[model samples]
Target: MTGTILTEDAGDGVRIVTLNRPHRLNAIVPELLDDLNHALEAADRDPAIRAIVLTGAGRAFCSGDDLKDFGTQAADEPGTRAYIERIQDVTRNLVLGDTPIIGAIRGWAVGGGLEWVINCDFAIAAEGTRFFFPEIAWGVFVTGGVSELLPRLVGLQRARELIMLGERFDAAQAREWGLVYKVVPDATLRDEALNLARRIAALPVGPVRDLRRILARRDALAPAMAAETDATVRGFLDPATAARIGAFK
Candidate 1:
């Protein structure tokens, strides 16, 4: 399935789903977000598809939300809150879904994009991949359970540096933080990620799926995500956030 995003069976129960907006660095627009959720849900529903490899088309895995289109979104607080919920649902699906997902991160993974990396079951990044959590820099709070989940991965201090201070980190640093499972040659990111996904898909689904579910800890994530979403809605409506966004524009 190919539309705003791309999805194709990569054989042996491994599906390859690419974020297809290369011209825009695969930024999250309404179309891309909706398509991504539909693709992930469809893959999970298909019994034949046991695992998924998510990557980008050209450079970035996803830069972030497309700020270019932000001005056109519904201006009211209620309308904006609903849109935020839709974005959070993508992360919810990724966290709770039975099928495991492998992220093939290449270039920039910043802002909302970095949230995906934190939520993926496994992430294989290219040596050249650059990561940053600049939501604070852009005057917005993170929608995903990044506040709660990120600290669990990299300790509270570093999570604050990354998300609160808005620092940029390299793949080597990301590997040290345990966010990336493997850092390979930049040229082979796709092949390496696909190979891992194929290996995962070849394993028996029952134990593999069960292990993933236990690790996901959806019971905790559900409420943490809800809290984050509610906080994000408030940030989205803040006059300071609006001023910063206007300046960015």
Candidate 2:
């Protein structure tokens, strides 16, 4: 399938979904979300596609939500809220899809970008790639399922540190923290990721899909609970405690 936000192709039972918005760091916009959902649904429906790889063009994998698209508007309000919900749904579909996803992260994966990585079944990052969740500093909370996914991947305390401090982690640090499965040199990242995808694609479909479903179901609940906790804390913070505290003079 071809679209502005995504480019997709199937080969040897592997469907590779490339995030196409290099200018925006492949940030999640409405159209991008729609296209991604469509690509994923197509892969899930296709009997031949046994594995999926999600990657971005240009230097960065994804920088986060399209702040340019959202502009300066607050996301908690009704109009923006609906948009956020749709974005979340897109994320949910990616995680819950039958075909397991492997993220080939090259450069920066921040905010919503990190959420995308967290949702994936496996992630491989380039050695110098950076990861962070900066929404707390933006006077908002993570709407892309980070709260739920982070803890499960890296444990509670590490997730809290990343979210609360908005600290950035390098690829090596991320691997140490259990966020990424492997980290390779920048030049070999894509080849490594593709090789991994091919390996997964060669597996038997019945056992592969069953194993994916078992893990996905268990993994799904953590994000949901994390979303609830994040919403509760975010609601109490309103404009956000971190942002408000910074205004003190």
Report the error of model 1 at residue 118, Å: 1.2
All models, RMSD in angstroms = 1.4, 3.7
C-alpha positional error of residue 139 in candidate 2 after TM-score superposition, expressed in Å = 1.7
lDDT of 1 by residue, 1-249 (tens): 348788889898999989999999988888888898999999999999998998888988989888887665436678778888888988877878889889999899988788988888899999999999767776677867787789889999998898888888999999999999999998888889888999999999999989988887778888888888777777777778777878987
Q: Model 2 over residues 36-90: C-alpha lDDT tens digits?
A: 8887788889888878888998989988876655433344556455556666766
Question: Which candidate has the top score in TM-score?
Answer: 1
The lDDT values for all models are: 0.86, 0.76
List clash counts for every candidate, in order.
Answer: 0, 1
Scanning candidate 1 in windows of ten residues, the lowest lDDT window is 68-77
Q: What shift in Å separates residue 177 of candidate 1 from its native position after superposition?
A: 0.9
TM-score of every candidate relative to the true structure: 0.96, 0.85
